[model samples]
Target chain A: MRDKFNEQLEQLNVELIKMGALCEEAISAAAKALLEGDAALRETAAAAEREIDQKERDIESLCMKLLLQQQPVARDLRTISAALKMISDMERIGDQASDIAEITRDIEDSPVVSHVPIAEMARSTIGMVTDSIDSFVRKNLGLAQEVIRKDDEIDRMFLDVKDELIRRIGQGDSGETCMDLLMIAKYFERIGDHACNIAEWVEYSLTGQHGDM
Target chain B: MRDKFNEQLEQLNVELIKMGALCEEAISAAAKALLEGDAALRETAAAAEREIDQKERDIESLCMKLLLQQQPVARDLRTISAALKMISDMERIGDQASDIAEITRDIEDSPVVSHVPIAEMARSTIGMVTDSIDSFVRKNLGLAQEVIRKDDEIDRMFLDVKDELIRRIGQGDSGETCMDLLMIAKYFERIGDHACNIAEWVEYSLTGQHGDM
Candidate 1:
């Protein structure tokens, strides 16, 4: 029975990774749609949000079923619960990606601003998300903690970029497009937050640590 | 044994409610500190934040113990997991409240511009936080959904207030002070998001639903 539960858990881990892949895809689409101004990619990512949504629901139900039917024991129980927790953050990461894409769609015709800081935030956040799951699969609590530690950097970058944007708009760049830039910054910050959450899930799974952040 | 497990679950619920009460206290202190420019209140809220953080860890540890020992079936497992998720959100809400208090400390002399919208946002968000817990206690999906629906109002109010603050600051209000105001709006928005998360957790406990933002 324990082996069967582990098997189910393994499948869950796989499905969750797939979901994470989609989130990365969506985030990539968001940046590409904005920097490249590709409307087709924008539409594709927007439509793909629903798929991520459905996967979240599906994984949630599976987790629920695992808890009820498999009656997970020991670390398995914690692992399944952690998986459930991670999925919510991952799904929200997808939402943030979609939100970024929406902003990109809105600002398609706007004058270009330097995308360096925003991309830097996304790249770091995506790294966290990936590493968190890798740590989860390997039961690497140290790696998970490492990911959590990096959240401070993500937050600092978010603030730096936000302050810069606010200062720019403060300096008379108050075009209607400012909101889109603000929203993009907001979405990137959210992705970083979700990455932090993913690391927390990894910690919860491995050593029962909760909310070092 | 089953009776003892049920009792422990009930006790867990009670403890979560206690944590919720702490969250409630923190939010009020933070809001008052922000609006009334009370320095001591900020310190009080910050101290309360420490307590909330400790309570969160304790609850999570106790919860993991219960899950490992009781091996709860179906509803019991759901309830326990739901509490785990809700407390995370609630604790984050506590952090946001303290964040608001800290921001208040930074900009104590800034004169208030428009209180009604932000005040309304705080009121509604607080209402959602309270109602989400009530719904969890009552196992009322409808009540939880109500809180979820009210989140839109809180978001709308947040956006309106933020825009107004930006406008006022643009019109010669202190830019330095606007940062404080922006942080307050951010804290309020975060609190609202956490309330929505709590409501979602309540819904998950009752029906295992987990999607649609």
Candidate 2:
């Protein structure tokens, strides 16, 4: 029975890794779509979002089955609970990426990446998402902490983007354009937040406490 | 053993209702602070947010204990899992409300409620939060669906707020003020989304499936 439980646990890990990869794909595609003004890439990101949603349901069922069959305790219980929390964050990442894609599609005529370091912010956020999942899969405490630390950079970049947009608005740029760009930047900031949440859950699963304890 | 589990489940319900009340308080306080330019109310919202966070940790520990000790199956398992999901949404509602209060603090000199129907939006959103939790506590499917449907109104209000902000920006209003108001509106919109999530979880807990089968 113990062997079977361990095997199921390994399967849960595999599912989580797959969901994380899909989230990365979704966010990266949304970023590329925004930067390049590529409507096709927006569609790709939307598809990835749908896939991620399906994966969430699958992984949720798997976790439920493990809990029911094995009734895991202590560290094992924490691991499953953390997985449950992590997937919600992952699912939100997917939704936010889709939201970004929607914004990119709205602004297909005039991409907003030229005036701000939005592409850089996107890359940074994507890295945080990837590293947070890696920390979870490997139980790497250092990597998890690093992901948490990266959120400050993401927050700073969002403010920089806001400042630049304000300057452009003052210079008589289209208000609608500036607003769209700000919304996109906000979406990236939120993606960073979800990544931070996943990293915190990873920490909680490992240490049974979250953040700076 | 079954009676003991049921009693603990009732305790969980009571705690959830309490957390939900805190969220409503936080959002309403933040809204009042914004509308009235009342710094004191902002502080109240922030305090409520801290309380909500503590409640989340306490409830999470309870859920973990219930899962590990009872190993509840079928409907019982679903109830616990739904609680897990609901608390995350409720916690997010608290965070978003606090975020609104932070924006209120930043714009104490020039309140943003004059040009938009922000007060109405706040009232509607607070209603949704209240009804969502009431549904969870009472297991009222009808109320849960009503809360979900009410999200459409909140979304429309957010768009209206955005359009008004854009118009203000076009008329050479302080971009900073307009941006801050837009952010505040977005936060309210997100709080509504969280309420919708809690309502869905309430449905899932009672019905074992989420949304139109």
Q: What's the lDDT for all of these models?
A: 0.77, 0.89
Query: Model 2: per-residue lDDT, tens digit, A95-162?
Result: 99999899876677663458789889889998999899999889999999999999999999999999
The CAPRI-style docking tier of model 1 reads incorrect
Alpha carbon lDDT at B173, candidate 1 = 64
Residue-level lDDT tens digits of model 1 in B19-82:
8888888888888876777789988888888888888878877776676677676777778888
> After best superposition, candidate 2 residue B112: deviation in angstroms?
4.5
DockQ of each: 0.22, 0.68
DockQ of 1: 0.22
Residues B129-163, model 2: lDDT tens digits: 99998998888999999999999999999999999
Off by over 4 Å in 2: none
TM-score of chain B of each: 0.94, 0.96
Model 1 chain B, poorest ten-residue lDDT window? B109-118
